[model samples]
Target: GESVGLHLPTLSVQEGDNSIINCAYSNSASDYFIWYKQESGKGPQFIIDIRSNMDKRQGQRVTVLLNKTVKHLSLQIAATQPGDSAVYFCAERPGNMLTFGGGTRLMVKP
Candidate 1:
Protein backbone atom coordinates (compact mmCIF):
# COMPACT_ATOMS: atom_id res chain seq x y z
CA GLY A 1 0.00 0.00 0.00
CA GLU A 2 1.03 3.59 -0.65
CA SER A 3 0.63 6.58 1.65
CA VAL A 4 0.91 10.34 1.28
CA GLY A 5 0.56 13.29 3.62
CA LEU A 6 1.17 16.99 4.01
CA HIS A 7 3.65 18.63 6.31
CA LEU A 8 1.24 21.29 7.47
CA PRO A 9 -2.45 20.89 8.09
CA THR A 10 -3.27 24.56 7.43
CA LEU A 11 -1.76 27.57 5.76
CA SER A 12 -2.88 31.20 5.85
CA VAL A 13 -1.86 33.62 3.17
CA GLN A 14 -2.77 37.23 2.50
CA GLU A 15 -4.90 37.91 -0.53
CA GLY A 16 -2.83 38.42 -3.68
CA ASP A 17 0.15 36.59 -2.24
CA ASN A 18 1.55 33.28 -3.32
CA SER A 19 0.82 30.01 -1.57
CA ILE A 20 2.83 26.81 -1.54
CA ILE A 21 1.41 23.50 -0.40
CA ASN A 22 3.73 20.61 0.33
CA CYS A 23 3.19 16.87 0.28
CA ALA A 24 5.31 13.83 0.99
CA TYR A 25 4.70 10.39 -0.44
CA SER A 26 6.04 7.03 0.57
CA ASN A 27 6.01 5.44 -2.84
CA SER A 28 9.02 6.39 -4.90
CA ALA A 29 7.88 4.42 -7.91
CA SER A 30 4.66 6.29 -8.50
CA ASP A 31 4.35 7.15 -12.15
CA TYR A 32 2.26 10.30 -11.90
CA PHE A 33 1.23 12.76 -9.25
CA ILE A 34 -1.65 15.21 -9.39
CA TRP A 35 -2.54 18.23 -7.40
CA TYR A 36 -6.19 18.69 -6.56
CA LYS A 37 -8.17 21.48 -4.99
CA GLN A 38 -11.22 20.52 -2.96
CA GLU A 39 -13.76 23.10 -2.02
CA SER A 40 -16.39 22.65 0.62
CA GLY A 41 -18.96 19.98 -0.21
CA LYS A 42 -17.35 19.38 -3.57
CA GLY A 43 -15.05 16.74 -4.95
CA PRO A 44 -11.45 17.53 -5.68
CA GLN A 45 -10.68 19.33 -8.92
CA PHE A 46 -7.48 19.05 -10.90
CA ILE A 47 -5.17 21.99 -10.49
CA ILE A 48 -1.89 20.81 -11.98
CA ASP A 49 0.20 17.68 -12.33
CA ILE A 50 3.79 16.53 -12.74
CA ARG A 51 5.24 13.30 -13.96
CA SER A 52 8.00 11.35 -12.24
CA ASN A 53 10.37 12.16 -15.07
CA MET A 54 9.84 15.90 -14.85
CA ASP A 55 11.01 18.08 -12.01
CA LYS A 56 8.43 20.79 -12.52
CA ARG A 57 5.35 21.71 -14.52
CA GLN A 58 3.42 24.94 -14.71
CA GLY A 59 -0.15 25.84 -15.53
CA GLN A 60 -1.98 29.15 -15.89
CA ARG A 61 -1.34 30.39 -12.37
CA VAL A 62 -0.14 27.27 -10.66
CA THR A 63 2.91 25.02 -10.66
CA VAL A 64 3.65 21.44 -9.62
CA LEU A 65 7.00 20.12 -8.58
CA LEU A 66 8.27 16.64 -7.92
CA ASN A 67 11.38 15.49 -6.12
CA LYS A 68 11.90 11.83 -6.50
CA THR A 69 14.99 11.81 -4.33
CA VAL A 70 13.02 12.92 -1.31
CA LYS A 71 9.66 11.67 -2.43
CA HIS A 72 8.23 15.16 -2.09
CA LEU A 73 5.75 17.10 -4.18
CA SER A 74 4.42 20.60 -4.05
CA LEU A 75 1.81 22.89 -5.53
CA GLN A 76 2.35 26.60 -5.84
CA ILE A 77 -0.49 29.03 -6.46
CA ALA A 78 0.17 32.59 -7.53
CA ALA A 79 -1.76 35.67 -6.44
CA THR A 80 -3.83 33.87 -3.90
CA GLN A 81 -7.46 34.91 -3.74
CA PRO A 82 -10.40 34.11 -1.53
CA GLY A 83 -11.64 31.83 -4.24
CA ASP A 84 -8.40 29.90 -3.98
CA SER A 85 -9.16 28.90 -0.44
CA ALA A 86 -9.61 25.16 -0.27
CA VAL A 87 -8.18 21.88 0.92
CA TYR A 88 -5.33 20.98 -1.36
CA PHE A 89 -4.03 17.45 -1.74
CA CYS A 90 -2.56 15.00 -4.19
CA ALA A 91 -3.29 11.65 -5.77
CA GLU A 92 -0.47 9.39 -6.83
CA ARG A 93 -0.47 6.12 -8.68
CA PRO A 94 2.21 3.74 -7.57
CA GLY A 95 0.46 0.81 -9.14
CA ASN A 96 -3.02 0.23 -10.50
CA MET A 97 -4.90 2.16 -7.84
CA LEU A 98 -4.85 5.80 -6.91
CA THR A 99 -3.64 6.75 -3.45
CA PHE A 100 -4.84 10.08 -2.09
CA GLY A 101 -2.90 12.21 0.38
CA GLY A 102 -4.07 14.05 3.44
CA GLY A 103 -5.12 17.63 2.69
CA THR A 104 -3.65 20.95 3.68
CA ARG A 105 -6.20 23.72 4.00
CA LEU A 106 -5.36 27.02 2.34
CA MET A 107 -6.95 30.16 3.75
CA VAL A 108 -6.73 33.50 2.02
CA LYS A 109 -7.17 36.61 4.11
CA PRO A 110 -8.06 39.97 2.75
Candidate 2:
Protein backbone atom coordinates (compact mmCIF):
# COMPACT_ATOMS: atom_id res chain seq x y z
CA GLY A 1 0.00 0.00 0.00
CA GLU A 2 1.05 3.58 -0.56
CA SER A 3 2.03 5.70 2.40
CA VAL A 4 -0.37 8.45 3.43
CA GLY A 5 1.19 10.55 6.18
CA LEU A 6 4.48 11.36 7.95
CA HIS A 7 5.72 12.85 11.19
CA LEU A 8 8.67 13.43 13.60
CA PRO A 9 7.76 13.64 17.27
CA THR A 10 10.80 15.15 18.97
CA LEU A 11 14.05 17.17 18.71
CA SER A 12 16.64 18.61 21.06
CA VAL A 13 19.25 21.38 20.91
CA GLN A 14 21.60 23.32 23.08
CA GLU A 15 21.50 27.03 23.68
CA GLY A 16 23.64 29.06 21.27
CA ASP A 17 23.67 26.17 18.84
CA ASN A 18 21.81 25.50 15.65
CA SER A 19 18.79 23.22 15.38
CA ILE A 20 17.30 21.40 12.44
CA ILE A 21 13.83 19.90 12.49
CA ASN A 22 12.55 17.82 9.62
CA CYS A 23 9.22 16.62 8.24
CA ALA A 24 8.06 14.43 5.39
CA TYR A 25 4.82 15.32 3.68
CA SER A 26 2.68 12.80 1.82
CA ASN A 27 0.97 15.04 -0.70
CA SER A 28 2.76 15.62 -3.97
CA ALA A 29 0.18 18.18 -4.99
CA SER A 30 0.69 20.40 -2.01
CA ASP A 31 1.66 23.89 -3.10
CA TYR A 32 2.19 25.62 0.18
CA PHE A 33 4.08 24.68 3.30
CA ILE A 34 4.31 26.43 6.64
CA TRP A 35 6.41 25.93 9.75
CA TYR A 36 4.87 26.81 13.08
CA LYS A 37 6.10 27.03 16.66
CA GLN A 38 3.86 26.44 19.66
CA GLU A 39 4.95 27.22 23.18
CA SER A 40 3.68 25.26 26.14
CA GLY A 41 0.29 26.95 26.37
CA LYS A 42 0.18 29.19 23.35
CA GLY A 43 -1.32 28.68 19.92
CA PRO A 44 0.86 27.72 17.02
CA GLN A 45 2.68 30.73 15.59
CA PHE A 46 3.96 31.06 12.07
CA ILE A 47 7.72 30.63 11.81
CA ILE A 48 8.34 30.50 8.09
CA ASP A 49 6.94 29.17 4.82
CA ILE A 50 7.90 28.08 1.33
CA ARG A 51 5.87 27.76 -1.82
CA SER A 52 6.15 24.71 -4.00
CA ASN A 53 7.85 26.78 -6.64
CA MET A 54 10.64 27.69 -4.26
CA ASP A 55 13.22 25.40 -2.75
CA LYS A 56 14.14 27.54 0.21
CA ARG A 57 13.02 30.56 2.22
CA GLN A 58 14.55 32.44 5.10
CA GLY A 59 13.41 34.65 7.96
CA GLN A 60 15.03 36.22 10.97
CA ARG A 61 17.14 33.50 12.55
CA VAL A 62 15.09 30.86 10.75
CA THR A 63 15.21 29.08 7.41
CA VAL A 64 12.82 26.66 5.69
CA LEU A 65 13.88 24.30 2.97
CA LEU A 66 11.58 22.25 0.80
CA ASN A 67 12.66 19.27 -1.25
CA LYS A 68 9.78 18.36 -3.55
CA THR A 69 11.72 15.48 -5.03
CA VAL A 70 11.77 13.68 -1.69
CA LYS A 71 8.57 15.17 -0.27
CA HIS A 72 10.60 16.52 2.61
CA LEU A 73 10.90 19.81 4.45
CA SER A 74 13.23 21.11 7.12
CA LEU A 75 13.40 24.06 9.45
CA GLN A 76 16.76 25.42 10.61
CA ILE A 77 17.16 27.77 13.50
CA ALA A 78 20.33 29.75 14.12
CA ALA A 79 21.56 30.43 17.61
CA THR A 80 18.97 28.34 19.38
CA GLN A 81 17.91 29.86 22.65
CA PRO A 82 15.92 28.91 25.72
CA GLY A 83 12.91 30.84 24.53
CA ASP A 84 13.19 29.06 21.22
CA SER A 85 12.37 25.80 22.94
CA ALA A 86 8.93 24.74 21.77
CA VAL A 87 6.95 22.24 19.79
CA TYR A 88 7.28 22.85 16.07
CA PHE A 89 5.04 21.61 13.32
CA CYS A 90 4.95 21.61 9.55
CA ALA A 91 1.67 22.06 7.72
CA GLU A 92 1.01 21.31 4.10
CA ARG A 93 -1.75 22.85 2.02
CA PRO A 94 -2.85 20.37 -0.60
CA GLY A 95 -5.84 22.41 -1.71
CA ASN A 96 -8.05 24.29 0.70
CA MET A 97 -7.23 22.44 3.89
CA LEU A 98 -3.94 22.14 5.73
CA THR A 99 -2.54 18.85 6.98
CA PHE A 100 -0.22 19.13 9.94
CA GLY A 101 2.61 16.82 10.95
CA GLY A 102 2.98 15.30 14.41
CA GLY A 103 5.26 18.08 15.60
CA THR A 104 8.81 17.98 17.01
CA ARG A 105 9.64 19.13 20.48
CA LEU A 106 12.66 21.48 20.44
CA MET A 107 14.55 21.19 23.68
CA VAL A 108 17.08 23.90 24.28
CA LYS A 109 19.65 23.03 26.86
CA PRO A 110 21.56 25.70 28.70
Candidate 3:
Protein backbone atom coordinates (compact mmCIF):
# COMPACT_ATOMS: atom_id res chain seq x y z
CA GLY A 1 0.00 0.00 0.00
CA GLU A 2 0.91 3.65 -0.16
CA SER A 3 1.72 3.21 3.47
CA VAL A 4 5.01 1.83 2.20
CA GLY A 5 6.00 5.38 1.28
CA LEU A 6 4.97 4.77 -2.29
CA HIS A 7 1.18 5.36 -4.91
CA LEU A 8 -1.90 7.22 -5.21
CA PRO A 9 -6.61 8.72 -4.51
CA THR A 10 -11.46 10.58 -2.15
CA LEU A 11 -15.31 10.59 -0.94
CA SER A 12 -18.11 12.96 -2.08
CA VAL A 13 -19.67 15.59 0.17
CA GLN A 14 -20.76 19.18 0.54
CA GLU A 15 -18.11 21.83 0.81
CA GLY A 16 -18.74 22.47 4.46
CA ASP A 17 -19.53 18.95 5.55
CA ASN A 18 -17.41 16.19 6.97
CA SER A 19 -16.36 13.14 4.92
CA ILE A 20 -15.50 9.70 6.11
CA ILE A 21 -13.78 6.89 4.21
CA ASN A 22 -13.15 3.44 5.54
CA CYS A 23 -11.22 0.22 4.83
CA ALA A 24 -10.97 -3.28 6.25
CA TYR A 25 -8.16 -5.76 6.15
CA SER A 26 -8.10 -9.45 6.91
CA ASN A 27 -4.76 -9.41 8.63
CA SER A 28 -4.77 -8.43 12.26
CA ALA A 29 -1.02 -8.07 12.33
CA SER A 30 -1.02 -5.10 10.00
CA ASP A 31 0.61 -2.44 12.11
CA TYR A 32 1.13 0.52 9.78
CA PHE A 33 -1.48 2.23 7.62
CA ILE A 34 -1.76 5.18 5.28
CA TRP A 35 -4.52 7.25 3.72
CA TYR A 36 -3.96 8.55 0.20
CA LYS A 37 -5.62 11.20 -1.96
CA GLN A 38 -5.20 10.92 -5.71
CA GLU A 39 -6.28 13.71 -8.03
CA SER A 40 -7.31 13.32 -11.66
CA GLY A 41 -3.86 12.76 -13.11
CA LYS A 42 -1.55 12.74 -10.20
CA GLY A 43 -0.15 9.86 -8.19
CA PRO A 44 -1.52 9.23 -4.74
CA GLN A 45 -0.68 11.97 -2.33
CA PHE A 46 -0.22 11.05 1.30
CA ILE A 47 -2.86 12.71 3.43
CA ILE A 48 -2.76 11.48 7.01
CA ASP A 49 -1.79 8.13 8.46
CA ILE A 50 0.62 6.52 10.89
CA ARG A 51 1.69 3.50 12.96
CA SER A 52 -0.60 1.01 14.68
CA ASN A 53 0.38 1.99 18.20
CA MET A 54 -1.99 4.96 18.11
CA ASP A 55 -5.71 4.52 17.95
CA LYS A 56 -6.22 7.82 16.18
CA ARG A 57 -4.26 10.52 14.38
CA GLN A 58 -5.14 13.99 13.08
CA GLY A 59 -3.54 15.99 10.30
CA GLN A 60 -4.67 19.38 9.13
CA ARG A 61 -8.28 18.84 8.07
CA VAL A 62 -8.05 15.07 8.16
CA THR A 63 -8.29 12.52 10.93
CA VAL A 64 -7.52 8.80 10.89
CA LEU A 65 -8.90 6.18 13.21
CA LEU A 66 -7.80 2.59 13.61
CA ASN A 67 -9.89 -0.16 15.13
CA LYS A 68 -7.61 -3.11 15.63
CA THR A 69 -10.27 -5.26 17.14
CA VAL A 70 -12.11 -5.44 13.84
CA LYS A 71 -9.03 -4.85 11.71
CA HIS A 72 -10.59 -1.71 10.30
CA LEU A 73 -9.37 1.75 9.34
CA SER A 74 -11.09 5.04 8.60
CA LEU A 75 -10.43 8.59 7.44
CA GLN A 76 -12.37 11.66 8.44
CA ILE A 77 -12.16 14.94 6.58
CA ALA A 78 -13.53 18.11 8.10
CA ALA A 79 -15.06 20.77 5.87
CA THR A 80 -14.48 19.00 2.61
CA GLN A 81 -14.12 21.11 -0.50
CA PRO A 82 -14.13 20.90 -4.30
CA GLY A 83 -10.38 20.81 -4.21
CA ASP A 84 -10.76 17.77 -2.06
CA SER A 85 -12.41 16.03 -4.97
CA ALA A 86 -10.39 12.94 -5.81
CA VAL A 87 -10.00 9.26 -5.16
CA TYR A 88 -9.10 7.93 -1.74
CA PHE A 89 -7.79 4.59 -0.59
CA CYS A 90 -5.96 2.99 2.29
CA ALA A 91 -2.90 0.80 2.55
CA GLU A 92 -1.98 -1.34 5.49
CA ARG A 93 1.31 -2.95 6.34
CA PRO A 94 1.25 -6.50 7.55
CA GLY A 95 4.83 -7.28 8.33
CA ASN A 96 6.84 -6.60 5.16
CA MET A 97 3.82 -6.69 2.89
CA LEU A 98 1.78 -3.67 1.89
CA THR A 99 -1.83 -4.07 0.89
CA PHE A 100 -3.89 -1.39 -0.84
CA GLY A 101 -7.61 -0.99 -1.07
CA GLY A 102 -9.85 0.04 -3.92
CA GLY A 103 -10.40 3.78 -3.85
CA THR A 104 -13.56 5.85 -3.57
CA ARG A 105 -14.24 8.94 -5.63
CA LEU A 106 -14.91 12.13 -3.71
CA MET A 107 -16.96 14.80 -5.44
CA VAL A 108 -17.59 18.00 -3.53
CA LYS A 109 -20.49 20.22 -4.43
CA PRO A 110 -20.34 23.98 -4.38
Per lDDT, the best of the predicted structures is 1
Candidate 2: stretches off by over 4 Å: 1-7
Error of 2 at 28 (Å): 0.6
Candidate 2 per-residue C-alpha lDDT over 1-110 given as tens digits, one digit per residue, 9 for 90 to 100:
22224355777777999999988887888899999999988999999989999999999999999999989999999999999989998899877977887789999999
Cα RMSD for candidates in order: 0.9, 2.1, 4.6
RMSD of 3: 4.6
What are the TM-scores, per candidate, against the unseen true structure? 0.96, 0.92, 0.86
- Candidate 1 has a TM-score of 0.96
Model 3 error, position 1 (Å): 14
Give lDDT: candidate 2, residue 50. Answer: 95
- Candidate 3 contains a number of clashing pairs equal to 9
lDDT of 3 by residue, 1-110 (tens): 23321112344578899988878766667779988888988999999877989999999999999888877788889998888988887888777866778787888999
Per-residue lDDT tens digits of candidate 1, residues 3-54? 9889999999999999999999998778999999999999999888888999
Error of 3 at 10 (Å): 8.2
